[model samples]
Target: MSDILFSLPVEQQITPCLTLCKKDELPVIVINHPKAKGAISLQGAHVLSWQPEGEKPVLWLSPESNFKQGVAIRGGIPICWPWFGKAGDPMHGFARNQLWQLIAHDENDECVWLTFSLEDNEQTRILWPHSFSLIARIKMGETCEIELESHGDYSFTSALHTYLNIGDIDQISVSGLGPNYLDKVVGGEHTTADKKLTFSGLIDRIYTQPESFSVIADPANQRSIEIHHKNASDAVAWNPGAEVAKGMADMPDDGYKTMVCVETAYVTNARTVTNDKPQFLSATIRCHKNEQK
Candidate 1:
């Protein structure tokens, strides 16, 4: 685990809020800066929490989620690469289950940034059988940014699957996803949404032609979350209904009421990456008071 996870110099590690510790069997790095606070799990290199100063958390984490390797922790941003969902073995690709190398970390008065890397090895070869280097870069502070960079001579599908925390799931509405989408909830049927999406029970749709940015209006929290996408043409809106949510071991029976996943995706098809042409996708999530919108 020491080789897989990184620790800064003694001076940096001695900060009041920075931590490199093991949570159960998982190696996690916790942040407690004045501008923001969060936790990053080395298992899958997944972000388990991110909350900017004086506001609700931008990422939702299930209290029941396990903090161990091989299990996908339910929250923050999970990198789904080489494949999304059940399209490939291990469900959402091998990248999320492997230990990632912490390549860089830096901070300033306003924000903190951490970058992780994962290169193809014998382990990943068992899954997609591709040669590549994947990067998960994160910025935390006034706003949080997640970037996924892939370099290799193989094609892959990937996403920054972000689960946002809201005061109440029913009181939120998501807008800026273009009118049409592939309704995965209804077995991948094509549908049109003429208005902002308001969740009732379950909502799982792959929206097409989404604007570069979208808003998650949370009336209960008296704030709105802005999600920005880059280098990708698709976005996914999903929430497991009560029934399904109750069945997931990682989530509480009612966990679906406080979370929603809006994934910035390049998962419509496998994207080709040549030695000279790497692929990149990102999502930036920011929050502000409702009145400011």
Candidate 2:
């Protein structure tokens, strides 16, 4: 592979080494940072996140397991390798903490592929001990797509969490989780078939076998975000509520009232991929304008 370098448009450099793409009449901003990876932006228009740079990306979506945000899928949107969140091992994995280099750009198609490697590192070898190449490509067009491809010698756990912007959490309800659900926070064994799925209090649960799911109508923006996932076996939902949000240094107390994550993934010793055959998992969230008819 050739060494590739990406140049940022002057207008965006003041914020970060970012690039913008406008295609299919949609706009996207790609932030090229060593510690942060993946697409970070708002739909319909670009919006900045509350999280500071040089830290793990506030936005996450993955093909592994939904552990973090963008939905609540578990372990978050982190690539947990060697050991997921163990002592000496980085919080999630090196993927989110390492700076990704821009490998290629497709202006006509409106796409950018960013790549990161762990093949030549002593620190990573000590931790992961695997030779691999991870590429996260953000494509803007009719559908905003984020593709994570891994090529190497190990299997890992991952998540694609999405913090969806909705009119009001109180006005929303999720559908399609079949009969019972498993709660991972308490223990992986407890089950619930009693309560209808509603968001009001502190919630952190991994659900499975849903008929289908969606966010309720948003009167604030007259738009709702619809999510879809593939190659995933589970889902997660979360909100910090009041007390938890206050304790969190990363989240604002009021932030919980505006965003809710509905993640798509497989979590906690669910699956693994290796050198012989690499596997993939992904999720997509699309914003639909709830026009007045």
Task: Note the Cα lDDT for every prediction shown.
Answer: 0.82, 0.48
Model 1 alpha-carbon drift over 4 Å, by segment: 1-17
Best by TM-score: 1
Cα lDDT tens digits for candidate 1, 262-291: 889977767899999989998899998967
lDDT string, candidate 2, 64-93, tens digits: 322121221221233333332332356545
Model 2, residue 109: C-alpha shift (Å): 6.9
Clashes of each: 0, 25
Predicted structure 2: clash tally: 25
| Candidate 2 runs further than 4 Å off | 1-88, 109-120, 188-196, 210-217
Judged by lDDT against the true structure, how good is candidate 2? 0.48
